[model samples]
Target chain A: MYRISYKAFKFEAKDALLYRIDPRAKLFVALYSMTISIITFDLTTLILLTIYLMIYISLLGKILRKIMRNLLVLTPLIIIIFLANYLVTFNIITSLVPAVKLITLVLSMNIFFLTTSPDDFSLTLEKLGVPLTITLAFSLSLRFIIVLSKQLNEITEAQLSRGYTLDRGGLIQRIKNFIPILVPMIVLSIKRSIDIAETLEVRGFRTDVKHTPYHDLKTTRRDVVFTLSSIVSITIFYYPLQDILSLFIPL
Target chain B: MIEFRNVWFKYDEEGDFILRNINLTIKRGEVISILGDNGSGKTTLIKHMNGLLKPTKGDVYVDGENTRDKPISELSRKVAIVFQYPEKMFFSPSVEEELKATLKNFGLEGEELNNRLEEILEEFRLVDLRDRTPFSLSGGEQRRLSIAIALSWDPDYVILDEPTTGLDGYSRRDLTKTIEKVLAKNKTVVIVTHDLEYLFEFAPRVILLSRGAIVFQGSFKELLENEDVIMRNGLESPKISMLMKVVRRDGGGCGMRYSELLSVIIERLGCSEDV
Candidate 1:
């Protein structure tokens, strides 16, 4: 009931080789291209990078419509950034280039978060020797989001039964509407986290213990090759791929 | 035999003790039952059998092996606890795989694993559901699948806590018959139940618990003869056990099996003259 969207996200990523790709690989290509896109103010380059990101995220099995839907939520905020850039620099091309960079960077992160389950992603971080505290922070915060959404619904229902009109509130007013949802949810989640931690301990969860995953994540050779190829595509596009195409078209 | 000598347990340190200075023994080949009111710590005590919960003070031993001293995987080989709402025990996808996983966890995989799995699935009438997802099955089918997984591991001491909690009459009988079959295999079954109506018919011993401690640990017949004790504990005599009381004659007793009680009823009515 909580983040019911995760079900649809799971269905999308079930076919995602890019998601199925090693986390290191996704980090290497997606993060690196995004960094380059930020440094350059070339409008043509930003457009190319955006196309690359769309194709890359599409490899996660999402269609154009799905990607646009997610982007639509950010469109208004993105337009605000474009307007701010236009006023600050008064260079329309300059503002447009960074705006595209901004959009691509956010899209890359969306791809990362959407395709990966918190469990697998955390385990991936752990395997890479991330600090226990850092991994735990990510795990608990992300886990909290899914659980908090569920608690929000439960709290709303309970309050509605008691004659609270959580449904009738403006954006600022909703902040006040959150006293019931916020207090009980935080209190309940902390208590529940403690109880669940105890339960996991009883079932033998230890930071120091070296145990195989009950459901192991084993990657095939195809996953390996495809990930390597995506990283090369990003690097080559930053230099050789774009240059090679320029010699032919002179654009 | 299972023994708890001076057992003291609390769900947490500095918390009120759930079971205080408890002393109990279940002899080998004996059918022992546990009874209690709500919040009586019946489940807390049962979990101590397999080291799922450790005692804060003293010890719980299952067949001379101290529970806290062994790893769960090892202790599980000796004592299997079927929890209340048995269907929830399965975390596996399909019934066959769920049964297979327990056998595998006990290091019982391979042809012998496949063979034993088939045999138990057949015994539990779960062969038809061997490929079916367990969570999608009916409530009764789900319960049967849970028992089949527990038995598939082939543990010695089986501890069941309120296994019939949410079951209907038909499912309850189905579970009881499965327990009887386990008994026929000479396994020591420790049943923690509040309802003795069915257990008194199929299982002989009915251990009574009052406030986290055993008040009585003996036959159901002894329970009926002591109505003051039953009433004081807020219990009613099971109907079949009460019906058998009329034919006690001189030395006979109530709490006979359903078939035996039926025969006694017919004989008292002079309806058994033909047989």
Candidate 2:
């Protein structure tokens, strides 16, 4: 099996517009966008929001490549949703709207995460009054998502090299082929977690004491303006504008 | 024999080439080592040997069959790779079951399968751990089990990637002895490693890569003599080689094992009577 590279989640250190914004502002934008996208059933509003997010992501330069790669991975799921809906409802054209909406929501989240590093994400959580232990747990989980996938990929390759064929099997047989891979992956993850815990203990990580960050997050004028505009736009779209549009446009 | 002709590779079309214009031939039963710094494409090159990766341009031939023509499963019968963290691949409840499953993939069954499994367990010194789960073994034992699983099918070519990583002094010696056993069976062995000491002692022919190209390809002695190439590639000479350089006042000969170094020192000190 080919290893899937989760390039989008990897941090980009370049100085782009999104990267330069305060992590809190970006996190707020992401949360707002996701909330607005979920509440609005209007296809036009979703399309407009998707276009806006697309334009913003396009401006991220090198990070745009990672976002595009992530979008490629989402293609199969989007296709499956569309096909399932069409099969059930027997309406191909209308069924696509939900799939497109899901894609837009994913793109909105990807835009935020692809630009923000894990360090900045934890800082955002800390700034939002999350417990230090929770913030540390969140950051460690994010880091290990990448690490565990790499371990899985290596394990898959190693098994394949040992003359283990994963392809060409019935459904049950195919899943059975993964037993060797899954068992080792779970075992390795447990081992890694123990190692991480020991390392934290050795480093004297304490939940009781207040911890200071290396890079202090300060909101600049650009961040303030972006955050305010995003909140206002999402507010207008989710409330009055959607209500007014729904009255004129049938359902 | 494995051959690469004008082979070039990149993971993405827009990405920088990882292996550029690699042309080389490894004859049957030849033991060779590939040395390179991180990101120098050592792993990428060996991945091509077993059809894990296909060249973007040109071709790779394993035993006169183009890698592109065969599936990885088919190519794997001719070449087996034991990855650095091979222990992570174990899934069988016991070591015997693990070997049995691998041999099953090669279409062995019944009495033949049991016999092959017994032989492999004996060869890797893993008979004592036959009933134990592979995950429960020590690090060194796990490594040996990994190699044993790879060799269960008896592929003509065995490639190891960074075998010495995370191995202790005794474990490293065990790995060396295992490789010696593989080589004794007249199997072609290819190793990709940063362990200069292992390479010096075991590999007679070394290919040094820098920036996706071979910079030096010769015996260890030639590599030692060309200090500029070694330094440029960010590699350190083996410890014994460095010590010999200091004592002899000039780099006369490079030694890997302790006994070789002792003999060199004795010869240098004019103690022929003892010899």
Candidate 3:
């Protein structure tokens, strides 16, 4: 279950400051961070951006632990990238840059997702001029990921109770053990998908019709201030901050 | 025997405890029914028996070993749990294979394994469905198969979580008979359920839980006699028990079974009419 929490997209309805932030503002922050990470080749800028995202995530309080756990799942991939880069460049500093960049990218996305609920995310997408179908599809996919993972965990435990050892044996043997889990998950998911489609049909869901949304995204003064501050910070990091730091850091 | 010493559990560290300071001791060969409303921590309590979950505070000792010390597979040899919606756990192509896999897990092989497999299939009345795909079986058959798979190794303790959820009357009766057969073998049974009527008929000892605390632990008769406890816990007494309550209120003796209650009512009516 923890393995799939990163994709769960749960909405915590708490009175926290981060929870009250507008989804649109969070989304822009995510986009700006990603753009900066992608365009900035200098290591100093990437490191600074990574630090900023880390501090932003720390402010999330309870959600910070979940975000960290989700990031732990990416640790192996980050290490692999670091090793691959080191093998090619034979320089420790250059090798570390790609790992930092990957971390910055993931942390930025996590900031958006961990703080924003699925409903808010879809509403943000809808307000951003995305078609309703695409937004629905996105939300539905996120929902199914959590559902399927839960089903998988249940199936795994069921087999485990029957004396099946999933963690034993070699890699191929472990994959073979997962057959019992995967088969039921796929079958159940297909059955669930059919049920969902039937329910949608019964509820009069039509792709051609323009539907009225019950909840509309509203931006407050906080959203404007947050978005502007994020853009400004990104601009500073992308333009002058890296050059100023480079004089002393030797990057 | 299973014992929980001041167990407290919550999924999140800072979240309110789901099972709070739960202290219990379940003896061997005793059929105990855990009754509670939703979110009362019934499921969380039973999962401790098999080491699927360890206590956030205190300890869960199975047989004499702390559950925290052993893996679930090691604990499973003694405690088997058939979860609610057990059919969703089925992954085998055929019913026979499912039971076979469980027996194999317990290291049973050759003639002994085959004998146990055949015996459980016949015991659960799944002989005809032995070759059928587990998913293709009817709901009752699927549930029976799930129980059969759990019992293939003949664990000393069997836990059923809401075994009658979607079962029809006939299936429910069949399940009760199956449970009776298991009890006849003297295997300790623990059932977590909302089916009070079934609990009234089968389980001798009832443990009522509310908000992660055990409010009552006694016989069905004691539970029936306490209207305040039953009503407060949001539980409806069995129909026979309710009738018995009405009879006792009018100065008639209480009876747990329908036949006994009917006789009491007839005796009361005859005496009143004669006067």
Candidate 4:
């Protein structure tokens, strides 16, 4: 119902500031954080990374609650990680370090995803010389995430009218209730994706022949600034010997 | 001309047949309006025209040529299909690009493309919104853009599935004008609509489909004369037609044309022509 108000699955980086920055730069920052978090297993390093992520969310992004809501799926896994570390590790410090690192990585991923729209990510990929086919596939999958969420609600409503109940049911019963909704949603998503792919292929998107975009995607100076800053941050964080830190690194 | 011979379709092998043994033909320069209930395979029947969905049993022919032997790009050049929901095709941002994408894909360029595009844009009155984002347009604007894009290729046959949906009175009126232009040019137009009012207003030959078969095929006027046929087939005559029947039953007047219907009202209401 709200797809239109939510821009109905269109180019909706509506926050004026968000739109000003180069899409490619935002994409670089997302990727850089992910890479930096994964390379370090030290507790101090992980904490510093988390602090940076927290500051970024609080200052630059201002999407803390929104990211938390998106990370709901990872919450249980996070709990499991904490429990597993408690039960399995000999060194409390060692176990906690990897756990913190993983959490930082997950949080960084959330920020990256939150800031960078699929259009930007694809543009970045295209610039990186990734094949057009792979970039297009990645885009469709990302587009499906937004489209399917809206569809899932409608399917559930239709199922409810048809005597399928999800209310007050135990785990098994709820699982049974989900079958009808999931079957149609996934089936329709796959069908529509293939249908759209066929439409694009017919329109000459997948072929080697060059075609102009219906909408222009200009590479702006902000994108350049974003790339330089991210590259500098990534270099500093990647090298253990380097002392490059945030000027406001809160030392 | 469009022809469907023994066309059968099922969603899957294990599923019930959605369309069965459908044999029908729509001749060139003839307007056909299809009316059916919700699950009466209205969309499924027309989706075959553009090769969006292929027949599971037999073949569909466009302009006397069998579609099974032709690629969709070739078929698309002859048969332009407007979907039930026009918003689904709105992948492009602006209206100009939306129509140009069709021409571009066909490798059309230069002054020829620009001239042809400007002509359609003016005819449809979408010239003002040529550079505006398609997604940001009103529902009516979107529907009109859908029609304009379909006409961009100038296909011999234009198929519209519920074109007036989500449109207001003025937009619908302009679209009727556009439809008349298509008719004047002798292009075959196949409209799938349950709007009996429009069917009556346009007076196209009606083809009523029920359970994947063409049950009635005749002029709209002749079909409305049979009460039993309309009732049995879950169809209703337009409000104007029903009103005309009530007036005709009272032995008042015998006016059939829309102008005649209006003049009949003028005479009955005692309005002087030169007053």
Q: Each prediction's interface RMSD?
A: 17.9, 1.0, 1.4, 14.8
What is candidate 3's CA lDDT for residue B151?
81
Best by lDDT: 2
- For residues A1-251, could you state the per-residue lDDT of candidate 1 as single tens digits? 11133322332345655556666555556566667777766666667778887876776646455667677877888888889999999988777876787787877666566667777777778778786657867877777766666555545433332223444469887676556456556556676788878987898677775656555566678767866776677667767666766676543
lDDT of 1 by residue, B141-239 (tens): 877776676777677877777777778989888887888888988888887777867666564676666776667766877777777777666566676
Candidate 1, residue B120: CA error in Å?
Answer: 1.2
Clashes of each: 0, 0, 0, 1
Native contacts present in candidate 1, fraction: 0.00
User: What are the root-mean-square deviations of the candidates from the true structure over C-alphas?
Assistant: 23.2, 3.6, 3.7, 19.9
In candidate 4, which residue pairs get closer than 3 Å at backbone N, Cα or C atoms, i.e. clash? Answer: A3-A8
lDDT of each residue in B81-102, candidate 2, tens digit only: 9887767778889999988888
Return the lDDT, model 3, position B111.
100
Positional deviation of residue A49's Cα in model 4 after best superposition, in angstroms: 45
Clashing residue pairs for model 3: none
TM-score of each: 0.52, 0.88, 0.89, 0.52
Q: Which of the numbered candidates is closest to the native, going by highest TM-score? A: 3
Off by over 4 Å in 4: A1-251, B246-260, B263-275
Which parts of model 3 are misplaced by more than 4 Å? Answer: A1-9, A13-22, A56-66, A127-131, A219-222, B248-255, B258-275
Clashes of 1: 0
Which portion of correct inter-chain contacts appears in model 4? Answer: 0.00
